[model samples]
Target: MLREYYKFLGNRLIDWSQTIAIQAGDRYVLNFENDDQVRQFMSVLSEFNGIHNFYLMTERSGPNALAFDIDPDSHMQLVVVSTVEVTPDYLVNLRNRIGQQQGVWENTALLFVSNKVLDSINSGAKDIGRQGGPFNTGALKRNVQATVDKSEKLSKDDKDVLKFMVKTIYDGEQELTLMDFADVYGIIEKGELSDSDYIQMGYFQDQDLATYSSKEERLAENHADYVNISLAHGFGDVRSRITKIVDGEKLISDLSGNNWQSVNYKQILAGKERLKQNKKISLVYDAEIMQGINEDMLIWDHPKGTSKAGQRTRYIIVFNDKHQNKLTVKFPFDATVQDKWITQSKINHKHYTVGTHKNQLVVDFSDLKTNEPESVKVRYRHHDIGSLGFTFNILILPFTDNKILGLRPYYRVKVKGEKKANLEIPSDMDELILGSGIQSNKLNVDKTSQLDNLMLGPNDQLKADLSQLSLDDDNESFTVTLGSVPLNFNVFDNDDNKIQPRVL
Candidate 1:
């Protein structure tokens, strides 16, 4: 079973051996060193029909050793080199192969390193735990804290000045974070701070003599000054956008008519609304508008036996300047559209001017000081006749030249009468790379592919490339029909399976 499970995994599988000393009821460890033997040893665990009588556990024994155990009440352990990199691809394949067991198995453990450590490994930061250099701010702060805490009794003002002086030192021309205090506390508890590191500390201490001030006064002054700096740095606009979203002053446009089943349509719309309201959700600001459906193009087939009722699917596109409204953006011509009116809710009384210019949708909200975030909905009938299968393209465009991260695309389809529709996203489509500065492959979902987080520039364009849909034929007419559920902004929380914001 193990061999077959890994048959498609290819070169990632290594070589191994089973210990000869096996006792009664004792599981053996399949020790791996090379490629061929590991392949042969894995064959011992194969059960062929995707059914396994046993399960596996992964362990990180050392910096170089990785191992897996198949304690099936009938089997053994498979140990491999610790030196192999624990890559994102490796983690994904391992999860898929483990096959979730029946009920919770407490003994089974999943071992992996944090992304920071993985990044360090990739960047060749091999010194492990060296300090005192420009990069070791944690160590520097610890030294400074020790010097301040052990010094002869000083005035409250002097201590505050010392602390601030140390902060400015380790912060190195950048903004200081809360962790500076936390790390100092950690070092103090561990007794890692000492007098030798106090030489430079004394210099900063002497410098503090001229700057001594009460903490309250310094914080108050800094707070007021930083507010202005933040505004100059774009926080003002962000605050405005967030205020609108939180107050629900924004408009939520929805359309429902034509062949769409009411229940399914409502459910899909509800999901989108939830996503939009999710507080943790992060949106790509300055999204580049792309060519969507060309006006009233024909898409989707009608129910087999019904008359040709045209397609009038709804489309809702949301825009938000995550940087808080510091950025202003005009509606992409593709979204500034005029078509059938369904419903528009100016819930918060947020005024908007919408119209069409030169055959494209045109919307203006600049007068309101809102730009980064915008949501538009338009419903229109497609001119094409119905068909069994359909193909469409999903375009991704970024509006700014800055490196944009975490841009993913998701889609949901609903049928009027059917509770669940069979949908498939083919693997043949071109691949997309997400941001995060890593080349991890995008996740493959229920038939569709994840719009993997992408790093795009103002002029860059990434396409879901193509979407091929095959809907289940309606039993009544034996015809396959397709419907669109405007892309909802909601994401599901993995822990409770409840709808929640996509936490960044």
Candidate 2:
């Protein structure tokens, strides 16, 4: 009875056998004596994981050979007889080759699929759905007919198969079967396909299956790798043009030809960021200093008076005999000297005109009477009027002699009711006397005169008799009398002249 049942089951399996072809390299004949065979075949399908394994299995088993397994529950029953057609090893190699080529085939496949869909819609194929079963023969036929009706560029047969393939593999509208891919291979072998068509079909299948709204946008995204590789290789003209655009040397409209459409969007965006950083660095190094004296040395005309705290005093000596004293004052770029004049009325001043020598201001002081003291205030303005400004004061003294006195020493003293005052003496005079009047204590007539202390008020007057005080050639000493009680006052020489004055 069991033998008879096995025979019956084998007959049923042969009757139920069917040839299935889903894609180019995947074709198999599935036979099942019963439902048990189908279950057994599905259980081991995962073991055939790669095309290499599938190829080896097909080669070992002849075209009509049946692969069977025993059912454990019913040890006598033949489980399965599955036969797959021989898939060429070259197909596996071709898949690997396409993968190595990266996005080349994927982009081509996309273009071909897009073209077919467009052609189908243009031919008034209204019933063609966007998605359907993996092997929708009706949709495939409509796509093929649409291409044929729209253009006569390709043969009807070639258009039919290529359109079917691109839709199956790229658009995922249908399953890509081994037989269909094999048909592609046959078409390629006959050289029936165009160069562009073969190039598109030869590339690897893209798993993403992403879609784009426009052809230009698709090209920019898909062909970015190709464009970059081309630029890297030797497309100097395109690279130069792109570089010019990135550097702001050229505009987008100046890209020339359709090269702009092919440019990688990511690279352009990155280039713009680099340009922004470069501009920031450029501003740091090349920024303008707003037309004024920004440096303290330039403003004060001395390295010592660089502090911004208070005004400084500068002394100028001019000879009485109409000898011109040229003072060269340096200022920042674009600064103008507005007006300079002496404040004293008794001195005869020259009508001075400010002149520039090597971008420095030159002021001349002349035509002044001897022993007539004057104060000159120079008012200058910068290019930017909104910025803060400073005032500089000059004490001008006219002397009778033309000898180079070499910077005479002056003593700064604080007087009553006056903040500060300077007392300057002749360099040749070694002895100085101070009193209410010149007493008769002279060894020689002209050298025995008394020198007034020039006190600011009677409250702080010095009533002491003639007292000789010696000062070093390079050092300063001070004497102060507060109602006949003399106190030591603070003084400074040229080395430490920046010390602030203390109250007496």
Badly placed stretches (over 4 Å) of model 1 are: 1-351, 356-361, 366-373, 379-433, 439-504
State the lDDT of candidate 1 residue by residue for 263-342, as single tens digits: 12223334335534553432121123322332212112111111222112312222332322222222232222333322
TM-score of each: 0.18, 0.21
Best by TM-score: 2
Per-residue lDDT tens digits for candidate 2, residues 1-504, read: 222223322332323222211121222222233444334433333233220121112234432222222222322111122222224443243234323433322211000001122231123222111344222344443444353335444555455545545544445455542134333433433334543443344321222213433333433333443444345435646644454334333323333335444433444454556555544431010013311323311121221233532222233332233322433333333323333311222222344444444334444444433334333444333221211233333333333221213123333222221112233433333333332222323322122122222222222223323124334554343443322322223333435343333356
For model 1, what is the alpha-carbon lDDT of residue 8?
21
Model 1 CA lDDT for position 448: 26
Off by over 4 Å in 2: 1-315, 318-358, 384-390, 400-504
Query: Looking at candidate 2, what is the lDDT of residue 504?
Result: 62
TM-score of 1: 0.18
